[model samples]
Target: MEKIEKFEIYQRRFLGNKLKVMPLIEKIIESEIKNFNSFCDIFAGTGTVGWYFNKENLQIITNDLLYSNYIPLRAFLSDEEFDEKKIEELLKEFNSIKDCEDNYVSINFGNKYFCNNNARIIGEVRERIHKYFLNDIINPKEKAILLTSLLYAMDKIANTVGHYDAYRNIKDIPYKPLKFLMPDIDKRKNQNNLIFNMDANILIREIECDVLYIDPPYNSRQYSDTYHLPENIIRWEKPELHGKAMKFDRSTLKSKYSSKEAAKAFADLIENAKCKYILFSYNNMANKGHSRSNARISDEEIMEILSKKGRVKIYEKEHKEFTTGKSKRGDNKERIFFVKVKK
Candidate 1:
């Protein structure tokens, strides 16, 4: 039985905005919190923070723009318990699926993201999973678990540094067999949890919880651009692709936090947050040199927006920023702003 943290291992390698300060968050919640029964993770990237609260007996409502991320959130946050034997049998059935020629990934991604044979195998596995889903061989949750497992497996063997931006040259590509692992989902009974695949700004309006956690994109790097391959896999949408990256049309998934409107967007989120306490996780990359200038929102803007909504207390911790082996480390610090909303 692998640990639940293994699910986040691959993501931590690339994704920058992970909740590494969860212990600090818990400490704050214990010290200043009056009453907290539910939590809403508006920018639930990998559902790490949501899972943390869920374990502490709080009902979790999590949302993310990426379907790839939503899959794991659905699997982990749901109260339904799955049979280990059933899941194991299903994995065996999926792994037994023979590689077929000329499928979606093989035809499109062959010799690009993976070797031709591996791509064909990936296509074969994905097609089989969908077939099981359509034929009612598996329930919706079961399907999500399987698909997420496959996505994680594919990510391990992908021929890239971490993201799907570019693949390694043919000669450098690793030749390893694809494998899947059942996600370390919590089996304990929980209160009904909700999961959504929508923009954070849009989702904040419809739900009210005791705590709202926001960890939006910190820079111009659109997550859809970085993890497009996994998105394509989970969506199974074989849309027209462009450039050397083979990326699909992601016009609708762009975040305001990654553009010139970031400050306004942050302000809007704080103003509209229908929660008692809003805990925001952002970094201090804007203070660094221009070469390491990835942050779209400045420190002053964050304080200005958060202070207007409630009594804001800021916490900071030193952390390393993720880079592509190009930029120098500029004083990186992850900050958390706890806003106690005015009644």
Candidate 2:
């Protein structure tokens, strides 16, 4: 078994991820926008777009509401110092642990989201990471890296399709032991990058960037509910969970963009945005899926809201859609609304 470099930050199978359309996005920005210094991914899901545009001369700002996402943002983009050898040693130690007592994950999420043995290991490793951080044995960046490694590893082995909304009915889930891998972080570029765990609408007014990239949830599916398992593991609050999905109280984490008030939220966000350019990523699933899975903001509403800002241009690319259930997303085409904000 050779040491493989397989842990890239973009490897996760995240729904509505911009991994495939990244090239189209970059092409539009490079061709149209010029003399830009900062790129802000206000609703960065996996932090893929921000990291893709991370250049030595450009500043990167990424924000997400979930701690699971924010930790990875800090781990990959922030210029915090971390010990490499210590991290490698800790991974080896965690992988070798055979005896782990019953903990939150094992007790609550075992056999549902993950297999029992892997769930126990997850609990044990998360506890150790928390203890190490509290005891000052590891720096914040190191802790983030470790937690991110655990998250990526768990995402690989989870019994869900692409998100934790529901799990498949596998009576005897295979014994795929959790293995940690070091994230491929670019250490030498854009040391001034900033990371935040704040609401995107509130954050829009506080920050200014040359290029503001917006990729909000397109449907009623809230990311917090979808990724609750990872959120619980990262926050480690061990709160009371309910429902068949084993979800904790996420009242505060729900985004209005995923609700009926999506058009209003988009309007407010655009009204306060202080940027030279706005790049909005949306899809043509307005009427494709079920009522809950349909696009919250219609194309007409999006056009009307953005037209008031400045000149708007639309870019379309045919891409495959990611769905959770029987909902059909036929003939999906990602649309990027490029707006040059009025000065």
Candidate 3:
């Protein structure tokens, strides 16, 4: 059979929101789908893996700790109807709101981040989005689309640098937001599904499924930093910002998920998760701790723990893009490690 791409994740989110190589994952689970009627994704990031695997009429469980992450996933995967006309109407009302300044847009706390025009547009749209949620006129899919559209708009108009590091370079206005930024999304046929707002480690113990898919943060690149602005916009709550006009807590904080405890923590999560099979998606990087830090979990470290679980099967593929100039990209191999627990 030929390899086919299920979702266009990379094309849609190239500069930010990088994803792990997924074909190996598709192949690993291709044979096992029949045995399991329910699926659970602990780190359901953008729902790329869960949404793609949502064939066979099986229920999919998706989770993420951040409110921003949870909102988008919930919007995408939940059982909700999407009403286009109503959303359009809401947008009309939102864009009518007055700008605080000619170029000023209202962010959290009425503090301005972008140029007045960008902020004004974002502020107006955000107001209407909040109204939509309050009126409760539509379902979860609609909500997700609303959230997604806003994020996409934010990405284009945001003054910050790519990958959401800071706004130091974005010293001016941005391109205008198109009306159909989010368009419409197909509602996931999520039968018997679950969504969670907890840590990956904590949830592993309680959830049980035939297959568990783990694509954790490869290095210490905290996810919060990469997409922090969109998260803030969706949260619709102004947070204290440290520098470059982003949420202080998110930008300045450390994630236990940030390889601060990745090795022991992930091993524990995998060990305790009451699942028959486990597949981990990570690359073999010499620099593991973080961009400017040391290694926390090495290639040997992970293989050791997963080895104890079952007879491990490994497949590696090239990372299509990376900052490094290497042919294989950041790591020589984007490793897929599969372990099966006896039923």
lDDT of 3 by residue, 1-343 (tens): 2221122222244331325556667777786444677777787776677777675468777787666667766656666656766666555544444554431135442223355555666766766567766887655566666676666555555554455665544434444543334343455465556777678888887788877887776666677776666766777676666665545577433456566687888778867988878877776665532353333577787889887787788877875434533233334566778888765
lDDT of 2 at 204: 91
Tens digit of lDDT per residue, candidate 1, span 1-343?
4322235422433476466678777877887785788888888887788877785466789899999889878876776656666667777766665657788898888888887778898888788788888998778788887887788778778888878888887764557777767777765634678889998788878889998888899888888888888888889877898888888999887888888998998888888888888888888777454532568998888888888878889888888776777667657888888988888
Residue-level lDDT tens digits of model 2 in 58-156: 899999999999999998899889888788888887878887789989999889888898999999999999999999999999999999999999998
Candidate number with the higher lDDT (2 or 3):
2
* Candidate 3 colliding pairs: 75-144, 103-116, 103-117, 104-116, 105-119, 105-120, 108-238
- Which 10-residue window in model 1 sums to the lowest lDDT? 1-10
Candidate 3 Cα lDDT to native: 0.63
TM-score for each candidate, following the candidate numbering: 0.92, 0.97, 0.81
Q: Is candidate 1 or candidate 2 better by lDDT?
A: 2
Which of 1 and 3 is ahead in TM-score? 1
Q: Which candidate is the best by lDDT?
A: 2
User: Which portions of model 1 show Cα errors greater than 4 Å?
Assistant: 1-14, 17-19, 80-84, 287-293
Clashing residue pairs in candidate 2 are none
